[model samples]
Target: MPKTLLDVDGLTVRFEVKRGSGWGKKSYLYAVDDISFEVKQGETLSIVGESGSGKTTAALAVARLVPAHSGTVMLDDGNVLEKQGEDLRQTRQKVQFIFQDPYSSLNPRKRADSIVREPLDNLSEKSEDEKTTIVAELFEAVGLRPEQMKLFPHQFSGGQRQRIGIARALATQPELIICDEPVSALDVAVQAQILNLLRKLQREYNLTYLFISHDLGVVQHMSDAIAVMYMGKIVEHADRISLFTSPRHPYTQALLSAVPTVDRTQRAKQKRILIPGDPPDPINLPKGCRFANRCPIAEAQCSQTEPELKDVGQGHKVACHLV
Candidate 1:
């Protein structure tokens, strides 16, 4: 079996918000509430959910971009949340991020080569000659010409800017890459190109990814394992095949139903599962399951007590009272 590259346990992230005017009271907006998952070496584990479901925050915490309230993020057997100063800087060399927006992420002032070489400049001890050589290689690896390295961020198209982002992420030869909707901002045709490039790069570099996205179709293309998050909790987790073929959680089913199918027979068979009502206010969450109010088959028990994510059969785990 492949070694676990990233192990997250009971990860929780919250934001303090005022309850009323004039700072009447403070409450915690539980963005990520006791979520856990693992990403093996060379495998892609995707977290899928709707907007405000805390998927992005979870990824941010794992990357150490945002502060985690409670949890242990173990990357290559070291506790990331405990690292400080120089230790934290060193840890960053092993983990990199591909941001969602290519246009906003890249610096307009810097040339393409400079942008790609930034990570090596900050985290690597490579000499100038070595760095230049590595940057050239990265540009080529991401399908950009060596001459194009002189161009600014504005000179490139959306797809090319993302390629630059990919090259930058690869500069450190990171053990884990946290991709937050890397293709969502691009055109539909460009999204496919970028996704294919990412897969190709992963195979070549033996990269592990913690992917976050609301698009189930994109998750289906890239994920080896899938975790369905609803309102700051993981409701279902399983391998790609199991999750897609036999989703146990009502929330997971609703998500999968929205993905457009190309096959006529499959489209005819698939029915759209509509989830009613908006998610509960994060600062005033219910005592039980966070999704209880919206779950179609939620029982009294679902609202009375939160269900633990347990293995129903095989390796599939679900946190649903009905399941």
Candidate 2:
């Protein structure tokens, strides 16, 4: 097995929410509540949930792009959350982010070559000529023509813009990449191309990915391990096959049941597990089980106390009172 590349424990990220224009008490929104997970070297671990479920928040906090309220992010070399000064700068070179929106993420004023060269500029002391050579190589690496390097962001198609973003993320030769729904903004055909490209890049570079997405099909295709999030918490985490075939968490089961299938027999065999009620407000989460209100099997005890993530063996973990 590969060694651990990232180990996060009890990570909590909070934001102050103001309800009124003035003189109102400030309430905290727990964007990412105390959650823990790890990524193995060269493996892809995906965080999947509905919108506002904190997958993106967790990833951002891990990348140190956002300040985390609490917890430790342990990398193989050091704690990512605690680094400062030059140390932090050096640590950031080993981790990169691929943003969700290709349109907004790239600076329209900058050419594709310049955009990809930005990360290398920040991380290294390479001269302009060397940087240009490296950028040309990266452009070709991401399947973009080197001739298109001088083109601005607006000159490229949506998929090509995303390729530029990918090239930028790869410029620093990062070991770990935090991809926050990187392909969601592209066309369906383009999404497939990007996915295949990511897979190919991972194998070629031995990269570890912390991929976040709402699409289960995409998660299934890309992830080796999966974490199911609800109300800013990880309710279930398991190896890919186990989570897909035998998910234990109520939320996870409900999520898988909703995935559309074409086979009539398979569809008949799979019982739909619809969740009841909308998710709780993040600003004022429930005191006990966050999913208690919507869980079909939740009992009186479920709402009275929070459940710890318990190992159910076979590399599966679940957080549920019933389980």
Candidate 3:
């Protein structure tokens, strides 16, 4: 069996909201609700969902950036959420985060070199010369020239700025990298370059990635395993090929159908499955399955009881009454 690099069980995150002035109702916003999943060593597990589906929140909770209201995020043997102060800081070095906006993630005032080297300076006891050497090596690894390290973030294009972010994430030699919509902001051509770089790095370094994205196209290219999220729960989880070719849940089917097909003949035969109704309010979620309101095949039973993620066949799991 492949060793699990990360394991998340019963993970839930709830945000409190103010109801009115003076006093507020502590309504829970279940950003991530009772989610359980695992990433094996050196594998890319892409979490896909519509906006506000809790993909980003799940990633943040895994990295221990946001407080997990309940459940455990076990990184190798350690529970990341339980650690604190120095222990948490040390554990964080093993799990780096690559934010979505390269333009905002990078320091506009600091040189690119400084931004990349910042991790090394904070985590490692490396000397000034050692930090410089490491930063230069990282630049080369990410396909950036060493001389360009002195330039500010604005000096590079959007894709290049992302590469710099990648370099910084690599600075600490983390075992797992949580990428939150890493390529959504880039052009189609630029997205490919960054994706290729990430794949190459993962192969060379045996790095595990938890990629969060709403774009099914990019998820198909980068993910070994895909987990589809609806509302705050995982609607389906399966291998890339399985999920793409044989989506069981209505939400997953609808999401995959929306991805534009290149073959005109296939596109002609494909019937687009449009999801109706806006997403339910997180603060006041409907009873039973969250996707019940939007699900095309929703039955009366779906509104009465929530479905649990159950195995169907060949490691495929789905949460739907019909499935």
Candidate 4:
């Protein structure tokens, strides 16, 4: 069996939002709600969902960027949520993040080389010469010229900025890299370049990824396994081929339908499954099925009771009463 690099169990993160006026009560936002999943040693396990879904929030919780309200984020043998101070700092070295927005994530004030070397300067006890060598090697690995290192973030193109971010994330040689919609902000052509770079790095370094994205097309290209999130809950989980070919949950089916396909036969027969109704307010979520309001096949039972994510043969799991 493959060694599990990261194992998250019942991980929940809640945020307090004060609604409007002074008289109003503070309601909680369930950004990540009791979700559990794992990423194997060198594999990418993608968390794909809609805009409001808790995929990014869950990744943030795992990295301890945001506080996890309850549950465990097990990175190998250690539970990240339990770590404090120096231990937390050390845990952070093992896991790094590549943010979505290339333009904003990179430091505008710092030079490209400075931004990439920041992680090493903070996390490692290496000498200045060692850091320089590491940074130069990273620049070469990410397809950037050594001369470009002195330039500021703005000096680089959008795709080049993202490559710099990728180089920074790899500075500490992290075992698990959380890529939060890394290519979503780049152009279509640049998106492919970034995606290809990520795959090459993963192979070269044997890195594990918790890739979060709304684009199923990108997910299909990169993921070994996929988890479908809806309203902060994982409604479906399966291998990429299984999930794409046979989505059991209504929410997952609707999401996959929205991905544009090139197969002419499929395009001719496949009708876009439009989901009805907006997602339920996070503060006041449905007691039963969260997607019940928008599910085309939802029955009365779906509104009355929540369904467990049960295995329906093979390793495929779906959380729907009808499934």
Q: What is the lDDT of candidate 4?
A: 0.93
Clashes of each: 0, 0, 0, 0
Task: Give me the runs in candidate 2 sitting further than 4 Å from their true place.
Answer: 20-25
- Please give the range of 10 consecutive residues that has the lowest summed lDDT in model 2: 17-26
Estimate TM-scores for all models.
Answer: 0.98, 0.97, 0.97, 0.97
Candidate 4 TM-score, C-alpha based: 0.97
lDDT of 2 by residue, 265-311 (tens): 87998999999779987887887899999999889998889999889
TM-score of 1: 0.98
In model 3, pairs of residues that clash are none
lDDT of 4 by residue, 20-128 (tens): 8867777889988888888899999999998989999999999999999999988879999999989988988999999999999988999999999999999888999
- In terms of TM-score, the best-performing candidate is 1
TM-score head-to-head 1 vs 4, winner: 1
At residue 9, what lDDT does model 4 achieve? 95
Per residue, candidate 1 scores C-alpha lDDT tens digits across 200-241 of 999998999999998888998899999999989999999999
lDDT value for model 3: 0.92
Please give the distance, in angstroms, between residue 171's alpha carbon in candidate 3 and its true position after superposition: 0.3
Error of 2 at 19 (Å): 3.8
